[model samples]
Target: MLVLITYDVNTEDAAGRRRLRQIAKQCVNYGQRVQNSVFECLLDTAQCRSLQNKLCKLMDPERDSLRFYYLGKKYESKIEHFGCKQTYLPEDPMIL
Candidate 1:
């Protein structure tokens, strides 16, 4: 499945900033970043649950927001991109 993760963290304080970084780090481990606060991840149910748990722990519900868009196995036809950022296949090999 393709999971699109997006987050908004209140970076008005040091702690908030730290949380934001931690969240981004965790997201990076599971997928590729498509925008400053958006990520495109390809994960199975268990992996997605694990990552969701990790992210939930790293964010403060009162100060941060997180969203997950689940695009099932046939996600290719569901997404459309019209920006400068190149589109990528989540299932393809990532060199780095």
Candidate 2:
């Protein structure tokens, strides 16, 4: 299965970005840092869960925040429509 995970990290500190990078690397097959506080990633369900777990562990409860979107089949269609060669989509939700 293929998944597109887009995330927003709501913090401006260097530590916050570093922690997010660490967590992202753990689960993403590929990623692009959109800005200092946003990122887009491609992953599988297992990978997404692992990444989420890592993010939860790294974030400070009061100082850091994270939001994730699961793009699933729509992500694959977008990739193809944009000329990407990939042809699969995740079939499960990682948040469970």
Candidate 3:
């Protein structure tokens, strides 16, 4: 399944800044970042749950925000993009 994850972390203090980096690091391990704070992750049920748990632990509920959009297996047809940033399939091979 495709999971679209987006987050907003309050960066008003040093601790908040650190939390933002920690959250982004976790996302980088599981998905590609589409926007500064949005990631598109292709994960199974277990993987999704694990990531969610990790994020929940790191976030300050009163100061941060997170959202998960489940886009099933056929997510390609569900996404539409029109921008200068070239988009690629999450399942496609990425050469670093």
Which prediction has the highest lDDT against the true structure?
Answer: 3
Please provide, for model 2 over 28-67, each residue's C-alpha lDDT reduced to its tens digit, 9 standing for 90 to 100.
Answer: 4345544444455666677778777777887676776667
lDDT for every model? 0.96, 0.58, 0.98
Off by over 4 Å in 3: none
Between candidates 1 and 2, the one scoring higher on TM-score is: 1
Candidate 3's residue-wise lDDT over 1-96, tens digit each? 999999999999999999999999999999999999999999999999999999999999999999999999999899999989999999999999
- Full candidate order by lDDT, most accurate first: 3, 1, 2
- Output the TM-score of candidate 3: 0.98
| lDDT of each residue in 27-88, candidate 1, tens digit only | 99999999999999999999999999999999999999999999999999999999798888
Where in model 2 is the C-alpha error above 4 Å? Answer: 1-30, 76-96
Candidate 2: clashing pairs of residues: 2-90
Estimate the lDDT of model 3.
Answer: 0.98
Clashes counted in candidate 3 amount to: 0
How many residue pairs clash in each candidate at the backbone level? 0, 1, 0
Model 3, residue 24: C-alpha shift (Å): 0.3
Model 2: residue 96 alpha-carbon error in angstroms: 35
Weakest lDDT window of 10 consecutive positions for candidate 3: 83-92
Positional deviation of residue 84's Cα in model 1 after best superposition, in angstroms:
1.2
